[model samples]
Structures are given as C-alpha cells and as structure tokens.
Target: MSSRSYDIAVIGAGVIGAAIAAQLSRYAVRVVWFEAAHDVAEGASKANSAIACTGFDMAPGSLESDLILQTNPQWENICRALDVPLRRIGALSLAFDDGDSDSLRNLLNQAREAGIEAELIAGDALRREARTAAPSAIEALHVPREGIIDPIRLTVGLAKLAVLNGVELRCSTPVTGFRHHPSGAISHVVTPTGATAVGAVVNAAGVNADLITDAAVAEPFTMWPRKGQFLLLDRAVGHLVPKIMCTAPTPHTRGIYAVPTTNRTVLVGPTAVDGDDRGDKTTDGDTLDAVWARAERLLPEGVERRHVTKTFSGLRPASDRTYRIEVSAKVPNLVHAAGIRSTGVSAAPGVASYVADLIGAEVMELPVKSSVRESIPVIPRLAEIDTDVAATAFTARPGAAPDEHPIVVCACEHVTAAEIAAECRGPVPATSLDGVRKRTRATAGRCQGAYCSVGVSFILSAATGDQPGEVRHGEPGSHWETPVR
Candidate 1:
C-alpha cells in the first residue's frame, strides 16, 4: 500500500476535530483528518441537545466553562460566513418551586463568577417572557447570550471550510494502531486501509476516544459514555416556546431542555441516563412519559405527546467528570480531547484553537500559508429570500437556476430538494442517507422519514450513482429501501 505523510493527523471528524482541522488549515502545514465512520460528525456531535451554551450552568472555572464562553461569539461569526442557521433567541431556566428558584439565584451568582452576563427575572416579567411556564414558576435566570444552533450544519460547515483550506479529510478511514519512533514522534497511523505517517496526532474520537488511544498507543485514559435522548416536536407546536427553555440543574444532570430550532420546530427531552450504552435510539416509553410529566410541571400549558415528530439519542464522552484536553506527557506526539459532553457543540471552535496551539508548540515547523483562503461558501437559506423579490426575479426569467425554485423535500422542516441535492454533491459530500440528513435535514422531519425517506433515497441514489436499495438510513448496513405493503 502506498504511504502518506502529514505534519498533523486528527483522529475523529466530529465537530471538535473538524474545528481543529479548520484552524490548522490556516497555516502552512499538511493536516490529515481521519474518521472511522463514513461521514464526519456522525457521533456525539450530531446527537446532542443543539443549544449554543452561554457558560452560565457550567462549573464556574472549568475548562468547559471557559471554552464555551469563548466559543459562543466565534460561532456567530463562523455561522454567518458559512450560512449555518443560528439564532440568538436567548434562554430561561425556569423555577417551579422555591428550591428551584433559589438554584437559579445561585446559578446567577455562578454565571457572574464565570463572567457570564445573566439576570434574575421574576414574577410577572418572567411569566410574560415564557407564557408556557408553569403557574407555579415564580422566577427564572435569564441568560441572554444563550442561543440555538444547527449542530450538523455547523460541523459540516467547519469540515467543508477546512477542506477548502487544504485539509485532507478521509472518511471510512479508522485508525487501528500507531507506531512511534524512538524520538517519541508518532511515525505512522495504521488504519483499515493502510498506514499513514504523521508528525503529531489528536484523539477526538468522542465515545471511542479512549478506545482509539488505547489501541493506537496504549494510552491510559477512561471515557464513560453518558447518554442523552431527545424528542423532536412538529412545527405545529413551535410557538409553545419562543426561546430555549430549561430547568434548574440537579446534582447528577442538567434537567430536560426545550429549544426551538432555527427551522421552525420544537425539541424536548435529553434525559441524562447512566451507563455507556450508545445504541438506545428508540425513545424509552418510560423516559418519554417522564419527559411529558416534567414538561407539564415546567410548562403548565405543556406540549402534547401527539405533536412529537421523532426521537433520538446521543452518547457523551465523560471522564472524571471533566473535559480532558491536554498533550500526553507519556505519549509526546499524542493530544487527547476526551470527555467533552453536552457543551461540545458550543466549545468546539475554542477547543480547535486550543488544540492548534498545542500542535504549534510541539509538532512540525510550519508557517502561515499565503494561499489558504479565509472564507468558505455559505449555504443559501429559503427563509432569508424575500418572497416578493423571488417572484420578481422568477417573473423576469421563468426558468432561471432550477435550484432557485424551492421544492419542499421535508414537509415538516420545509427543507428544499435543491438544498438536499446541493448538500449531497457539495464539498465534503454526504455518502449515506444519514449524511444527507445531517447536511440538509431531508429526513429529520415530523414523519421521521416515513414519508420523505423514499423520495430522499431516490435523490441520494441519483446523486451518488448508488442503487436505491443500497441507500442506507441512519448508518451503514441500515438500508432504507423496502417495498411497502
């Protein structure tokens, strides 16, 4: 097999890795990103409660707290340039009981200590802000900086931008092992395909980060998987809550959150269950029942379960109850970015810069590349286009770009067919149905792909030259095509 070399190799193409790759691409260095799966951000990055955290709830001085606060504004800038959907609608942590209300006050103090701008809104003002709140709720902590982001689009944008900046992204390329030279530099990374030499390596494999490091270099670190499950509500219930809503934090987990995504849909749940089982995508009946009960307690006008569109789960890598991000002293060329849980989406960009600094200090001698471009192509938004303006343009030229006219592919989310087609063929093209779903939200609607799966499969097959039967769903080996009775 032919060998390849790079100044740096980043394992795991999740949001953290993609962000790091994007940052590293700014310099004159050969950077290679490896993903065990067929697509990037297929792991925890895609699954979380897609909230842009404001660092208010985090442990005041933790690395996560610092990174999240730092990355929030950076994400705004990045998403603007990439056309990734982001809304600064703000957040409210409601308090039903006096205990919860006191907790909010404590969190406000913590937010202040963490340098987060937060205020305690009480009584009628809090009631008016979130009309759906439980009548028992006397107050809330209003975190004005908290927002919602499209997690998948954000990760894809970062990866695409990194590729455009000259980062080599190889999917379906899982690193199996590594060989270190006597000088303490990792000389080669062994993958299923073959070995590739690199000067330094980053471990950002999420739930499997520890496994990857143990197998690759026998690095000692433990990663416990914490599962978070979420339920997507139809757009019909989108008006129930305007801004992202949450409950006061408990000792074990941050209680369920209700967030209205950029696409007019409401999301709820994310019950933090114990253990490392990542396979539980099927929403637990008990969990859903509990979530509904909690929603009623938090929002008296509470959402209906009948309005639920889809349910999914994500596993967070937890280690020693803290985010592990540091260069391995035992393994000189290896950098570990493990134990990044729920806040990962918000902390990704800052984590990238931090990792880039580590790479600059320890790895290859490199300079800033003059040829590296500073910007990436932004995805067009239907919501941003004025209907009257579009009509005038279309009237002038009836058949302009076929893509200009929106053909609704996912009725629940209003995603267009043109958007799906573009996502399937654009930079860092999606290869599977899930990849397309992540990139374009084609099959992530209320029907949960029951209605649009077939059509999207046809579109994906037509784009990738794959047979409809071969077009899989959520992951590879999970085919979506079967004749309906």
Candidate 2:
C-alpha cells in the first residue's frame, strides 16, 4: 500500500545498521531504516557488556580486529557529534593464578601486535590500581584504549541523526523476505507492512540476518544465539572500580568483568551460554549465581548482591568463523554484514565505512547531497547538566524542573514532566515506558520502575492522547498485556 522507494535500505536498526544508515545519509541517496522491534536497539544492541574495546583481545588481522583498530580512535568525535556519553576509563585484567599470568603475557604481546599500547604492572602498582581485585592477584594487564559506552544511547542517537539527515525510519516493520531482480540482485524487500524496492540493500539484521538472506545467497556464516547474563550494580559503589576490571578468557567465555558504566554504575558478568533459540535472552538461576561469584572473586570488597539494581541478559549473534563483512557474491547488490559477535558495538563505525563504500560503488550513481547535517542537538539530562545550564533550561519553561513545579515523574533519576513529554515526541520518539527509559533514564534508577511507572504511564497517556490502560509498555502484546489500539 506504500508507494515510497529508496536507493538504499538498511535492514536493522541496531548499532551497525544505525551507523550504516547515518553514514549513508552523508550522501544524497535515499536511505530508510527498518526495525522489527518497537524501537531501535531492542535487540542485543540494548543489552550486553557495553565495552568500547580497543580490539586488543581480538585475533590479530581478523575482520573484527582490523575494524576495531581502525575505528577505535574515532569514537571521541563520533560520540561527541552523536551526543552519546563515552569515556576512556580503560581496563585492567588481573592474573590471579599461573594460567592467568601466562594469558596476561600473551595478551600483552597480542596488544603490541594489535597496535594498542599496554603495560603489565605488579607489586605495589598493581595493588594500588586494583584495590578491589582479588587478593590472589599477582599482576595486571592495563590497556588504556578500551573504554565504556552507553550502547542504547549510541544506537538511538545515530537513528535520530540519520532521521535528521533525511533518512526514513520505520519501527515495528519486519522484513518478511527479499524479492530479487532478474540479475539475481535484490530488488524488493517484502515486509508485513509493505514492500520497498531499492537499488541496494545491506543485511545487518543481527541474529535474524541469515534468515533474511533467503534462497538467493548462501551465507558464509552460521549464527547461533550466545546468551550473556549481566548484573547492574547501583552507582553508589561505581567509584570503587575506576577502570574496567576483568579476568582472562576461558575456552568459550570472555570471563567475568565489572566495568563502570557511563551513568556512574557498574556492570558485571555476562556469562556466555550458547543456545539454539535466538529469542532466548532469559538468565538461569545457576548462571547468574556463578556470574556474581566470579565478579566477587575479581572485585574483593565492593561487589554486593544487594546493590544490584537489575539483572538482565542479551543474545549475541555468535558464529564459529570470524566476522563476515563483505558484499554477497551470490546475491548482487546485497552486502553481508552479519556475525559481528560481541564486538559489534565497538566496530560499528568500521562496518559503516565498508557498507558505505559498497553502496557507493553498487548504487546506480546515487546523487550525493550538497550538504549533510552530521550532528544532533544534545538532550540535557537533569542529573548530568551543570547548575547554570539547568537554570537556563528551567528558566525557558519554569515548570521544566521537578522542584520548580510538582510535575515530577521519575524521582529516582530526577526526571521531570517536561523531559518525559519531550522524549515521547522527539525525532526518534519513545513509544513505551522502556523506550522512555532508554532515551531519558527515567525508570532506570534504583527503584527500577517501582517509583516512576504510574507517573510515567500517565505522562505517556497525556503525551499520546491515549487512555491510561491503553498505553502499552514497549510494544503491542508486551508483558503489560494492555488492550491494543
């Protein structure tokens, strides 16, 4: 029923897809972003061990390593332009035993080959650096390039900037299949809502990417769901670990790590469990217990279960082979950017660069825009803004602050009424409570939606002009089970 067409279509709205769409918007070509979820970053992009690694741990010369190294230094500019929070807090890998000591040396050598400056410290230096590390720790590998980032904010900011640059974003639109032109190149992408014919397509559909390729292309990789469970500790104890704390990797796992988040909290665990069902993001009782135990072992004093604000899990698109980032040889005009594994967030910019190059060469002379808007206006969070800036923001609208007027909603995170309303109607709008949390950190505090859910629901109702019960949580048929519109 839709008559619109695009020169290029991105199939996913995760970090990779959003970055690709944003980068492509630099040109004049028509680019549209599609997401099956109700909002961007509802997949692995929203949850995971959100480390912006420097690729020091990756296999040298692999696709993931190359991309990471190439894009690592660019994050400062990217995050600044996109208005996402990122910091070079670095990481410290502790060696508690002989095997870990050996792995530490190996990692140091690998870091050298990967062009990352690394140092191994022991004795008083190690003790001083890793105050919370296990007492058995002998030495620690410190890599200064690895940092932490807000993954959801990065994804949403990219999607917003892409939309600002004239890229169409379609949430709740699931691509059913791909119809090809006579030349064996993809022509039309069929979705539940409608079909879109495009000159080129990029397959960045996360775990569902293999299914999206269809019978036209034989995928080079097989993707299995690798579940990683995590525990988010409150910000009160976040300062105990100044750098990312971790143990060495095992045969299948990346080991447990406790990293400081951008929001002044700590994220630990992420036990890797391989499974058949891609939709299985549920955490097991035994797995979470082991994860916390491992985290405590790494951090001797501060880590506590009572401080845990949330326990969640994410599914990484795991594969046996290295990351696949190439144009499909089987399907013309289709680029394959799947099986990025745990490194997708760190390597997204590099992935975008490659996809842009491929689309530039393949598209039938898509016109380049004369000018492109690359930056998005920063949304000032009340919790993070300076006193003067907060005053200025509130002065523009006197009722903007919770203290000024009793329009307060999320008291835990100091989110006010005007803020929630703006997020619900932003460029990349929030459709549900969780969406608002991702955009504004309203219900993401210690209360965990306990203190703010009703007020947030009321604000959402008012914002959308829907009844209180009609406002869904994240999507239609969400766990809220509210009546559908």
Candidate 3:
C-alpha cells in the first residue's frame, strides 16, 4: 500500500545478509534488509554443522578459501560485540586407512599454504588426543582453529545489532524483482508490499539468487540445492566426542562429522546429499543411516538412532561456481554475494565487510555515527542459570499484582509464561509456534512440543490477538494442528 526509499537495499536476511547489514550500520546511511522467511537464519544458517573452521583444507586459490581465511580470525571480536556463544574446541579429520592418511598429508599441506595450523597426529598421540576416536583411525589432521557456534543466536544477534545501528530489517518482505536505470545501475527493488527506491542492491538470496540476477541481466548464475541431512543427539551423548571429529574428505563430498555443540548437545551429521529441492528439508532414512554409519566409524562408541532427539536437514546454495561474491558486471550498483556453501557461518562477517566496502565506494559513503550502539541486549536463558538465581530474579521484577500459581508453560525446556510473553512482544516478534520455539526454546525439548505446543499456541494467540485455533506452527500457510510427518 505504501512505498519507501533507502540509500541501499539488501535482499536475503541469512547470515550473509545480516552480516552485511550489520557492518553497513557502522556508517550513517539508510539501509534496509529484506528476508522472505518469517525469521532470520530460517535456511542453511539455522542448520549446517554450525562449525566456524579456518579454511585450512579448502582449495588454496578458490574464493571460498580466500573469504574464510580472511573471515575466521574476526569471529572473536564479532561474537563479543554481538554477545553470541562461541567455542574454539578444534577439529580432527580422521584418517581411517593408509590412503586416508595420504589425504591428511595433502590437507595439511593445503593448510600450510593457507597459513592455518594443521598438524598431523598419529599412533599414540592420536589415540590419546581424542578418547572417543576409533582405534582404527590410524591418523588425523588436527585443525586448531576450528570452532563451534550457536547458529541461531549468531544470526539473530547480527540482525539485532544491525537494527540497533539504524538498519531497518523487513522480514517476510520478499524482493520480487529489480528495476535498473539507463546507465545500468540498480534504480530500486520491488518487494511484495511495494517498491523501494535504492542507490544499490546486494543479492544474497542464497539458493534463490538466480532469479534476481536473471532479472538484472547478469551472467547466468544458477544455484541448485545441496541438502545436508543431520541429526542432533541428546546432551547425554555430548561426552562421546571430546572435540569436533570428522572423516577425510572424498573427491565428491566433505564426508560426515560429529561435534559437541556449544549448547552441550552432540551434533552428528551432514550427509552431503546433492540436487534436492530448496524446500526439501525432509530427513531421509537412507541419508541419516549413512551419516551415522560414517560418524560412528570415527567415534569409539557407535551411535544408535535411539539417542537421537532430532533429525533435520539444511540446503546449501550449491553452484557450478561456488562462493561467487562480486559486483554484477551487467547491472551497475548490483553486488552479488551468493553460493557460499557449508562454511557460510564462518564466512558471513567476511562477506559483510567486503560488501560494505563495495557499497561505500559505489553507492554512498557516509561517515561513522558516534552514537551507534556497540551491542544489543541479550536475554537470559533460564535453563543455563542456577535455579535459585532464576527464581529470585523472576519474582524481583517490580509489579503490584501477585499470582499464586506461576505459570510454567514448557516443562521439558523449563520455559515460563513471562519469558514467552516478553519474546512474543519483543523488538523482533515471533510470528509462529516455530518462531517462538527458536526464540524462547519453548516446545523444543525432549518431547518436541508434545505437551507444550497447545499452551504455546494459546500464548501466541493472546500476544497476536488471534483465535487459539488460528495460531500457525511455522512460516506462512502453516498451522499448528497437523503434525510433521
């Protein structure tokens, strides 16, 4: 019904887009970030292995290697500013056979060229280093800079910081197309609501980038979906792997891996299933079985399906030319940051910095604002705090009314009514049951919303002023009544 204008417009609110938007906020400029999903990181950023590894084993001269190598070192400062959780536990690419050992040597050689510290550990040292690593693994390439992170927290934190820096985030605003000027520069962007006039445009649309580029008359940069099926084991299984354990990469795939997530859950995953649809997040039985079969080979104790709490999948924006981040040749003021595969989480900040520099040169150069806030407020999780402290803090809030029965909505995850209410009405409100689950952890426990879903739906209804039955489960066109099959 109404249209707005901006100095710049960024399409896609995944890690890449969020990082770009956040970085651009450092300067005094009008920027708008657009996301098609109900929430940020709803795609590959939410899934993936969630590992922030140095691009040690990447192709030495490739774009991905360059971006990751440059970006990996900045994570500490970035995470600190955003208040996101990060753990630098390191990783070991296990060599199961003599041939795999040869591959480890090659991977280490590449690491050396990339200036990353990757050591070859074998025999007694290898066995003692990873207690859970199988004895059959004769050697491993020890990558010291590899780390694990909470992907959801990282994406949300970046978006929040961007919002704080005066970057307007418009979630659920899908960019329909682009209009170009006579001189070949991007004139503005067309969204579902209305067109937004802009000086420049950045296409970080993940798998859907080709649609935007095609309309802009750029070279055909087609992207296909490369699905990675993964499993999340219970916290009890976290002790099974002391560090991020992985297998030597094959020619076609990155192989499978297991990690102890920062959240204290054992994450086993990433079967490199290629050529699936972007919307195909379906966890296939065959792929999952394959994933565990490979993952168990690297672990002392084999993993059983019984210990698995969640089975899910994420799609990477696979392309013939991966990590093709550059300014569009055909369309002026059009920057393209797409096809950042598995290492998106690690490479996001780097992408953002690069895109920001491009925008500063091409679009509008604005001075840094002195009043730009450094950090956004972080909410405390009740699950991590001491019970006594949480209880005392919960009741300490200044209020005249007192209730005899303090409502506890999610017993499995220990989520309470007050926490749900706060997030439902927070700066970036939860639009669906899954949105609330990601924000508050309600109905995301062992039972997987078996008991708390109805209550969460009721709370959503109250917060959004909708009828209880009208509460949706996830994204648009989805409802809570039907279970995921």
Please, what are the lDDT tens digits per residue for candidate 3 over residues 74-122? 8887788776878888899998888888888989999999889989998
In order of appearance, the predictions have TM-scores of 0.94, 0.94, 0.93
State in Å the error of residue 295, model 1: 2.1
Evaluated with lDDT, which candidate comes out highest?
Answer: 2
Could you give me the TM-score of model 2 versus the true structure?
A: 0.94
Model 2 RMSD, rounded to 1 decimal = 2.7
lDDT of 1 by residue, 92-196 (tens): 898877888778888988989988889898877887778865567678888888888988888898898899988999988888888888876678888878888
What does the lDDT come to for candidate 2?
0.83
Error of 1 at 88 (Å): 1.3
Candidate 1: deviation at residue 1, Å? 3.8
**Model 3: how far is 357 from its true place, Å?**
0.9
TM-score, candidate number 3 = 0.93
**lDDT scores in order:** 0.79, 0.83, 0.81
